[model samples]
Target: MTSAAVNRRQAMGAGLGALAAALAGCSGESGPVRRLRLATGPEGGPYNAFGQALAQAVAASGRRIEIVPVSTAASVNNLRKLDDGSVELALAMADAAGDAVLGRESFPRPAAVTALARVYVNYTHLLVPAAGPVRSVKDLAGRPVAAGAAGSGVQVVAERVLRAAGLSDTSATAPAPPPASAPATERAPDPSADERPLGLAASVSALREGSVDALFWSGGVPTPALSELAGEMPLRFLPLDDYVGALRERYAPVYTAVTLPAGVYGLTEPVGTIGVGNYLLARADVPQGVVRELLQVVFERWRDLLREVTAGARLEPRFAISTGEVPLHPGAVSYYRSVYG
Candidate 1:
């Protein structure tokens, strides 16, 4: 062949290859690698641990997709990240997710997000010093407490729990001492509860230092940090079942009465508290195939996830599809249907 003809043929081949690459990128096809950002909770939290485990297992599966876990304040913050396009996926409490869909609480407007699965249940933990005078939610008046981190689902629930108990945010109102074990009817809008927004580690530290009398956290049973803290000092978990009724009556029915069985944190008997489902969320605009594939890996490699999350029960289709109020992504719907069939 003539030298000029040879050069022209090579140029045409290169142009075709470039076009194919562009198409693959747009379609998220097998020709290119796909990296997705997953917004998780702060370090040492269940969401963060689950995200890391998920990323590792998915990588070992040799799939074309790569999950990158980003740590934040959890739930509400994670949802905001997903809504703003900073992250493609998020781990959120169902109560916060429902509030996001309704454009309330931490969310300023309706978030464009959908659930991939209801991953697990978060047990509301209200930790108080064993020797402290705060025996019930009513005793929290005028006492400083760590009410989860700012912009977190834990914080959202903490606020609701306080409201349900007829207490007001300490940040908004002056602290005043109330009688111990005051009735809810008498506690209406009591501004004496001193609530401080702090994360797991900080809250544990504050509690240990006697800076805070109580701490509220929501996570999987036996959160590693809290478990370790329990070993160092005798702590007590305040029962919250009473507040769940008012929580459901005033807000969405996302709160449930659940038992924190004995042996966790060395309790002699079961502690009744609120339960909220944790959900894996994604932007509503995410491709259906991507969500489906992600769910496939999650269900198949669930054992690996369990090692990190300790979600009490096996990750199953029936339980996963129970994400109330927050609609499932179409891809998740398709995946669930396939399993049932």
Candidate 2:
């Protein structure tokens, strides 16, 4: 079959899966459910872990819907998938989502994405081995680093952090063979593949093997993988607190200063860093009812999710409007209004 025919079949298959899952969740309730596809991050990343937990909670919300979380590179890549109709919902960084809607940066043209909720703040981390000499972002100038996988929001954050610090990635990278990501979903290629840096896991491994100086991570804190790695070995965070203004100027106004409390990773003092909100995004044309239901998953099943994932529990209706320049989905607005008013 041709690519077009294949895509049509995929859509039909996705629709069928969505229907089946929704019906399974309903048990004996008589309600019509719309299935949605959620574009999450790489397999082990916070987005993926938290997204999976959130998906389960939604499936059990006693609502008329089902969500399929597809592992992706996050943010920009998710937005691109939204444009192509490959996914109906996506976990995107506020900055990348804003840039896509404006047809700037990674996006080639204007995108019609809207926000379901400003979920949580993604705290950018520049982690280096405690014994390693590199202690700041500026010290990474001539060192090997893992900027994040291709097309990942982690890469987007890494690039901006580097540019603000007046450093450039001159590390030479060899092509990495693609591995199966989350069953059968083909991960979109990273745009900055030519200027290679290792991905998160690879960077952590490299740090242990003494190949790379540091790795950049932008996700909710108490990230399980990083926590486990830090527990195994001492790690230090290079502060990005000073460059918040430069990052905001270069990206969007959504950037803010945040402090990673000391001891979350066993450090003695708090670490300062820049943060960006990660939004639950959807195409502007997705049904308002679906968006409202997605938001409902966040509000209704929040406590259960909190037990499942710390980041997943951080969803608050008050902070739901924090997604910087990205406009809210009408369905979300309706849901929020019903609650707050």
Candidate 3:
């Protein structure tokens, strides 16, 4: 058969599986349709955008599962919802996921969650005014900075980056005073950055209004809100790749060096920055059959889904299985075995 014929055959098989699942769901208790809540990020953010698209795609694919995208504060909040059994699927930064699994950082205890796939890479973006006094990460000391929203993966990484840059007090969630043993000269500058917990849009507004000296954001290249802000004002991106080694050494080894290519947001040269993987996660108890069917839609219809996500994201099955440290859901392992074998 031709390639097109094979494609049609595969699509038909998937549709049949969905139909069977739907019929099975119907046979039991004339119950409501099987809906799974997906915890996404703040409105207009990458997580929410992609989650909405994925939910729509699943609906269009005639799957028995209805993915409802729930707007949230992003990674950390999403993970808590999963811990409490409020959501089945969530999008999270790899660093946050690793921390949750190991009971590190914000998580007081290890969380029971499993990965479905490593969906994409989020570039750490540190936006500053072009003519501002803050030229580098170290220059952020004693300045007002709009860190990411409280309980967001962006905040999680932002705090680490600040600590690596020796601005320990810039952390909004957990701020600690400089050690008393340290000499005055060796301590951080007199006053530390005033860290505010602001979401993407609010951060952009704060930056534009001169209320904050810099803002930290983690998202796909050319995050829509930031892009719009760039058009309205002259902006400079501070490099974060310099601290990747420190972040990896102190925290989990989830940070990688990545570049935002030139011409994006009117840049004249590529900017090296820190990168973190984003994962599609589920609670440990999600049904195996449900996960299997969901993975079918995610993999087979990934091209359509990609158009809805960040530009540089990779959704291929080969890359999807690289959820380091966080164990893969049994259904995800089964799906990959079927594809690879």
TM-score of each: 0.86, 0.80, 0.86
Q: Pairs clashing in candidate 2?
A: 150-190, 151-190
| Better by lDDT, candidate 2 or 1 | 1
Which segments of candidate 3 are over 4 A away from where they belong?
1-32, 170-191
Candidate 2 per-residue lDDT over residues 261-336, each given as its tens digit:
8768787899999888888788888888777777777877666645533443466777878776788888888988
Q: How many backbone collisions does model 1 have?
A: 0
Write the candidate numbers in order of decreasing TM-score.
1, 3, 2
What's the true lDDT of residue 91 in model 1? 93
TM-score of 3: 0.86
lDDT of 1 by residue, 182-259 (tens): 976776454556889999999999999999999999988888888899999999999999888877886768899999
Give the Å shift of residue 130 in candidate 1.
Answer: 0.6
Query: How are the candidates ranked when ordered by lDDT, highest leading?
Result: 3, 1, 2
Best by lDDT: 3
Error of 3 at 243 (Å): 0.6
Alpha carbon lDDT of residue 267, candidate 3?
A: 96
Runs in model 2 deviating more than 4 A are 1-31, 169-195, 306-313
lDDT of 1 at 38: 98
